[model samples]
Target: MDLPRHHTIRESSHRILDPFTDAQLATLGRALHLTPGTTLLDLACGKGELLCTWARDHGTVGTGVDLSTVFVAAARERAASLGVEVTFVQGDASGYVAESAVDIASCVGATWIGGGVVGTLDLLGRSLRPGGIALVGEPFWRTDPPEAALAIGDFVTLPALVEQTRDAGWDLVEMVLADEASWDRYVAAQWLNVRRFLDENPDDELAPALRHELSTAPLEYVTHQRPYLGWGVFALVRRP
Candidate 1:
């Protein structure tokens, strides 16, 4: 299926869908020293949170593209509410290029749009101006995962992740990682969202799936992802 409706429903209540807190997002902006008039292009941008917030705080302007119509609508509403110079389009992010090259290009938390991390980097590069930054949010193996966890994901170790970026023709310049707290917040919020959704739409078609996921997700995270998986957004510069 080219489109998955379930993820949008599962994360309906989230603004920043990744494991990054608002503080961490602000920290990344500060670390980048974002100035007025900088432009961003975010592929697979969830709710356009990065674009809207950066536009508000750093005086940047940006465009975000995501596949989910609901997310794009939400992003537009957010932009209107925040009075930000940003546009969110609903379409497949893979192979989408900006009309004009942007200062920053990113595919955070959805590298699958381009198949994987390296592939996503190549896709993000297509919309980047010369010497502009590329950002990728990805998961790494914090430690060796058990066979079960390995079966669940295809993550590499952190060092290997850096090497993959290098191989993909970018230098990993900076990164902001998620600790257990941020991870918990991101994952735990889904439970509440699912609970609320189920309560409101008990007879909906997705209820069974959501109920099944809610029942098992916490245990799954604690047993597998918690100890082994780590997520972060890494900033990159094109290799000279």
Candidate 2:
């Protein structure tokens, strides 16, 4: 029902949980051409940054669902702080559905909640109006990994991703890929957050694990993840 404490601690300072910078997110929003009063249903909506920002910037109304109680609370607070009205529910996003079809449905960087990309798209489709947009944020392999055993299993190449979306009955309309800088910022920020948590809670039971993560994550990210992984938010629509 709630995220593990360690996960929350590691991402405590993140506004946007994905590897998307504010500018990139804004660009995606613009690409969507979201009009005022557009409805958005965001699943696994960590901290509600996308909903809150879209609400404030585009006048879109939305509901966000997440399993992390901490993140849900932060999302609510973020909505309030932005003076935007957004409903953030603390629950499993996989089982949640909108009361009615929505203009935009998104499940960013948490597709595993619905099993994988195909299942996640099916899940998101349940809340999307016919012809409405679906925004799926996922990672792809930038290049073949040097060590096949160490490669991330969930990620495929960009072409494979597009083909998968097509096979699932959606057309890829637009996309915003995260550059190296964005990836570094996103991953590096988590290290800092984890380190800060460890510093402030040296006696905590999870300190050892957090300390290990803080120590090793940067090198692992830069060496293995940075060059190999590409993350992006894709705009898709159901094909007739």
* Per-residue alpha-carbon lDDT of candidate 1 for residues 1-101, written as tens digits (9 for 90 to 100): 23577788778888998999999989998989999999999999989899999999999998899888888889999999999879888898987999999
For candidate 2, the TM-score is: 0.97
The TM-scores, one per candidate, come to 0.96, 0.97
lDDT of 2 at 214: 78
Model 2 agreement with the true structure over 1-240: per-residue lDDT tens digits: 688898788788899998999999999999999989999999999999999999999999999999999999999999999999999998989888899999999999999978988888889889999999988999998888768425556578898999999998999999999999999888888988888888888999999988888777788887888889999999999888
In candidate 1 the C-alpha lDDT for residue 30 amounts to 91
Can you list the residue pairs that collide in candidate 1? none
Residue 39 in model 1: lDDT: 92
**Residue-pair clash count for candidate 2:** 0
Worst 10 residues of 2 by lDDT: 145-154
